[model samples]
Target: MILTRAEELCRERGVQFTALRREVLEAVAASEPPPGAYDIAERLSRPGRRVAPVSVYRALDFLMELGLVHRIASRNAFVPCAHAHGIGENVVFLICRTCGGIDETTSPEVESGLGKTLKRAGFTPAHSILEVEGDCGACRDKARGAG
Candidate 1:
């Protein structure tokens, strides 16, 4: 379903979703805690063929431009975005420190408040990404049970 949506968006934007880009997205979506560009390049490389880091970075750029993926700046990793919310909306990545899990969500109230603040400061943000690090619900529950 995610791939299908990506394909549709590319078609709508009159851009080709090339094979390498598809492969890159597939690798990102398959991994947990996301994967860095070098990790993706290594995974895509085989015995006879080699995928360069630059090539992977280029593919990541394309994916990110189309809102098909996101960069977790602190981790230097890339994650596939399902485009669950409106385009250009703020993305909040709930990163679980204990389990290395990530859940993506969006908030209109947050966007509204930030937009007002940015407007007052005459600052425009290209993209807003909030990464909150902590233990997720499941991890907290597990700890409680163990205790």
Candidate 2:
């Protein structure tokens, strides 16, 4: 994940960064996969930051609302939002069951299709997340016992 020019963003939003918040954001930025609250707590503890799980969770909530994060529902984890400023477009996530890898993509076709279906059903989508599960190549190879 790439961070914005910190000075620029902070200036724009009048946002102040605390040490713990910075650490948490950096950890999330550096995570190979999206991290759950527990995962974040563990990492924070390892660094001797002494940040509590609840605190980390609260920080995550703030970051998400700030448009700096995205949650992967299937994994119950959070990832840095690719779009830093824009409210994210609806995304479809391909999640790997074995290795926990995730790939996010957008599909207007899917959005319109689902919207039309929901409209017909007398429902409107205020929010949506479409997650597809499968084994990633590495995990598939691991199960097959191939080096």
TM-scores for every predicted model: 0.91, 0.80
Clashing pairs in 2: none
Predictions in order: lDDT: 0.88, 0.75
Candidate 2 residue-pair clash tally: 0
**Compared with the true structure, what per-residue lDDT tens digits does model 1 show for residues 1-147?**
668878988999999999999999999999886889999999999999999999999999998888889899878888889665556778888888888878788777888899899999999799777898998999999999999
Native-vs-model 1 lDDT?
A: 0.88
| Cα distance off (Å), candidate 2, residue 147 | 10
> What stretches of model 1 exceed 4 Å from their correct place?
none
Model 2: per-residue lDDT, tens digit, 50-110?
A: 6789999887876776667778877798777655445646877778887777766678899
Q: Which is the leading candidate under TM-score?
A: 1
